[model samples]
Target: MSDKYTFLTQAPVHRVIGVMAIPTIISMLLTSMYNLVDTFFVGKINTQSTAAVGIVFSVMFFIQAFSFFFGNGSGNYISRQLGAQNTKDAEVMASTGLFYTLVFSLIVMLLGWFFLEPISILLGSTPTILPYTRQYLGISLLGTPFIMGTFCINNQMRFQGFTKYSVYGAISGSIINCLLDPVFIFGFSMGVSGAAVASVIGQICGFVILLIMSQKEGVIHYTHRRISFEGRFVKEIIAGGTPSISRQGLASVSTIALNSVAGNYGDAAIAAMSIVTRISMFIFSVIVGLGQGFQPMCGFCYGAKLYDRVKEGFWFSTKIGTFFLLFWSVVLIIFSGEVVSLFRDDPEVIAIGIQALRYQMIIFPACSFMMMANMMMQTCRKTIRANILAASRQGLFFIPLIFVLPYFYGLFGVEICQPVSDIISLIVTIPIVWSAFKEMR
Candidate 1:
């Protein structure tokens, strides 16, 4: 434990974040593949199947919100506790976070089963896409508890400076999902349902591997006996995690709103937009990976009251993240049509998706700063500022624009909504981030 704390505090900021970012970057890409792999295989079956997976992705995001809420929330507290040499509190938080994540995810699964069809419709499923969406969503519900649990544990593990396990666990599930996708979707003739099954199986594999990794030397152990329901422990998790949940939960909401708006054009529009969103996320994983790496270091430095180190790490990561995204955005824009075509070959889908993808890519480089700032704020316990920035992209800006923009520009409005939101959110992020750094001193 002492060794881990020393590494987080004394290690050179660039070297430490680099060591952390490598595995986390790979892990984030693999995690995104959980959706992209399914999208890739399901597209072969038909556009409706592709659309089904996309529609159900909102539920996956919502489930992930719980994981982030528990995982990141607990992780922030755990890293701080370790920094302060408070081992007992760290153990209790590890167990408590795991226990609650399992319970909450199970509840989500049960509630989803009762309202499956309504959710499918609400998530922008057209009549043709309804049946396929139901099949995919039904099987996906069964895996919620496991996937959410894995996500929580993964975050906990990364926060401990054991990010190699995160990469390994993510790789295991991604490989399994990739191998199983074709076999189940084609060999078993299961269609969209098969894609969902592959994802669930992959998630279960990840969950099992992560559980085993948690027992590794120098890592925190999760046990029921250590679980705490005390207000102090609970509040710590809430304070650290609220920003993550706000971001992810509102992502689900914004996606649902985007789909509903796109539906007016046709199922083709829905599929195109869905593919575009997935593509954007895939490219943006680099930023998320960097933020993940920055978080643990930020939390530890702030906890130890090495505030200058925390500030330096944030700036270093933000610069690196923005550069990487800038490079990728240029590449993606140059080949936007082919990128969208790789997911689905339909002329209409590709055409609509290309425009959306290109527009989003234009603003993509700006998101890195937004994310790094939010993570820094959340780790430093600047909850209100962090939550506002977290919610700004989807909830504060995107949701309202989705409804208002279409009235002015129709289908073009839907295509441009997210980029416009990113711009506004980027503007809002500057003042909040500026205020946060000032408050930290």
Candidate 2:
């Protein structure tokens, strides 16, 4: 066995996961922080501007959905192929995934520009927020190709355990975005358009840097020759990646539903919910990082039939993640108002943001297991169960709740819908995870 493969399959589970997770954690944090930075700066523009940013998030969500679709699908397959000592298949699949994402980017950008205004309106923009939404969403659509490409390559690298390079790209993009945000927004006087421009520039930079870094000795480099149109490769990608697409695609729709419902209350409600989503996302990014660390290991150990190690990695991550989020919950809950105010100081915005933030945090820890299960199941190639689990939180549950809660509780229902979905999703995942472990035994 190759030294790297042996280390991955046999290393102490904690040590392996811990080492792999650090860069990914940092990458996810920096990426997530950029969104918060956008929210923080745009909040200063006006509540309507903030609401516009929130509405555009549905577009961003869709971008990420396809990116993760290629990323997770090819990534999971690459890790397993490498584990089984098949470098040629891994190399081919790597390029194929990126090739697919670029095609998706072209389609999204074309359709997005063709129907920009109507699309913005469909994303739940109020008349007051529509202009800003168009500005932001226009810039977002322009950067779709670069942003989605960056995300796709980053996932491919992470699954291969060469996260060392992925972190550099994430850091570069985040730093540039941060520096450019203030210059464009306040210095250049571009308003909402400024944030969008800065963000896209960063994605372009990250995409370039990651392409360079992927050429390092151990990482898989994308080559056109390796791009395969074979049915088997496509099937593997679908099996592994469908969970991400399901999770993210539904998340895209769910955010649209969320923004649509929040708009019913007013711009303030939309702005408040937007702020809460950013803050909660920042916290959830850490858990995702931890699960990502576990993923390669899960794929590797399972491929090698080292089933016990796979289980160990899963439990180890779940325990650490639950506690980590639980601790953050306490901190965020205690300072909910204070944190919400940091993003936007409007009294109405802060009031609504605080209530929504606290509601999500109340059952926040439960989300750790749900997320980890999906990652684990997908990595192990349990497609059907994983897809079902992936669909539950944002799709089957969140969509219905978002519509129903507003009918009964008005704004309060909008605020509470997500956590309720989360609670029920956790319940659904318990049986799936148990059965998976039983099968492994």
Q: Please report, as a residue range, the 10-residue window in candidate 2 with the lowest summed lDDT.
A: 1-10
Per-candidate TM-scores read 0.99, 0.99
Per-residue lDDT tens digits of candidate 1, residues 1-441?
788788889999999899888899998998897788889889998999888888999999899998999999999999888888888998899999999999999899999999999989999999999999999999999999888998899999888888888677778888898899999999999999888899899989989999999888889987889988899989999999999899999999998998899999999999999999998898788789999998888878888988889889999999998999999999989999888999899999999999999989888899999999888888888899899999998788999999999999999999999999999999999988877778677
Q: Write the per-residue lDDT of candidate 2 for residues 1-441, one digit (tens) a residue.
A: 276687789889999999889899998999998999999999999989999988898789889988999989999999999988899999999999999999989999999999999999999998889999999998878788888888889988888878778778888998899889999999999999999999999988998999999989888888999999999999998999999989989999999999998888889999999889889989999999999989988988898899999988998999999999999999999999999999888999999988999999999998888999999999999999999999998888999999999999999999999999999998899999999999996
How many residue pairs clash in all the candidates, one count each? 0, 0
Off by over 4 Å in 2: none
lDDT of each: 0.90, 0.91
